[model samples]
Target: MQDFSQARNQVLQQIQHACDLAHRTDVAKLLAVSKTHDADTVRAMYDVGQRSFGENYLQEACHKIDELKDLEIQWHFIGHVQRNKTKLIAAHFSWVHGVDRLIIAQRLSEQRGHELPPLNICIQVNIDAQDSKDGCAPEDVIAMVEKIQQLPHIQLRGLMVIPAPNHTQAFFDAQALFKKVALAYPTLQSWDTLSMGMSGDLLPAIQAGSTLVRIGTALFGARDYSQDR
Candidate 1:
């Protein structure tokens, strides 16, 4: 096993390199994808000074949130979110990165009572237009953005896309799509965050203008699925 200090530094260096290459100094935010990692690892990361962590599973995330409530960590829901869990998700997660449907948005907006702060949301886009991907297509982003803007309880931040793997050219295409959406929607003032890329293709995504990169194995090493079994 690698030392957590070394691992954290390596990832932070990579983030700095990506940001420098993109000519975007301040926008690059590293969200440590902590799904499947245990509480010990999460605390280790926290000990090393990582404030933002990403998780895919709702229940799993909730458990971790409860366990590590003492740490000042910002949790981001990075996986396919179910409509049934809107209330819990809204109540816990500070940001939701996979919102693709208006119904889900409406549910979250309604469940987010006025007592709580507005939920920070990013409309996920399947830039590659994969049929199975859980994001809105690039062409439909404008309509979705318009609808999301009307919800006073949800703050529309920007767009997120999971491009098709192996198509390295998809990064450029995704950036073009983001530019188009930004041009179409004037209310989206914070068209600043582009939550794209992962371990294998983050460089190109950064070159294509990505602000946040969700990295898992690269930082924490391969996941041990045996725990779930």
Candidate 2:
């Protein structure tokens, strides 16, 4: 197993460099993307005092949440969440980063049953306009955010996006999209978290105004996709 302390330090260095170059807000939060990784790895990160983790699968997140119930970990749902899985995610995860539709938002709000705190949510935007991606189109993002605002069970925190891979134009694409949403949703006081960037291209995302970068391989080593599936 890799040393969490060393990994944490390395991740911090990357975050610091990004902040230094981009003049990013000092409050940018790092979410250790722990999807496909096992409980031991999560525990290893927790052992090193890391508390925030992001997951891509509902079932996998449920399993990890149950196993790590005793730890003070904040779970983030970062995948294409289905309506059927809303209940499970609503009950456990503190944040949902892939909420792109009003239906999913309403279901998540209703399923919470007044038992848990309002779910922190970010509207996912298809900044790259990739047909394969699951997010609201850039042109329609404002309307979506407005619809989600009516739901009281969920707190609209900010915007999230998954830009095209390995594209040199990612920075401009993400910045433009984020700026559009920020302008449209100016009334929403908490619309500040831009959950963009990933292990491969976080620096550009930061330069484009991302306050939260979902990093996996950089902190946990390359994922074995075969085992993940």
Q: Look at candidate 2 and tell me the lDDT of residue 140.
A: 80
The digit string of per-residue lDDT tens for model 1 on 16-76 reads 7877887875746788899999878999988988889999878888999999999888999
Error of 2 at 72 (Å): 1.0
Q: Which ten residues in a row have the lowest lDDT in candidate 1?
A: 185-194
For candidate 1, the C-alpha RMSD (Å) to the true structure equals 1.7
Candidate 1 clashing pairs? none
Off by over 4 Å in 1: 227-229
Per-model CA lDDT versus the true structure: 0.84, 0.84
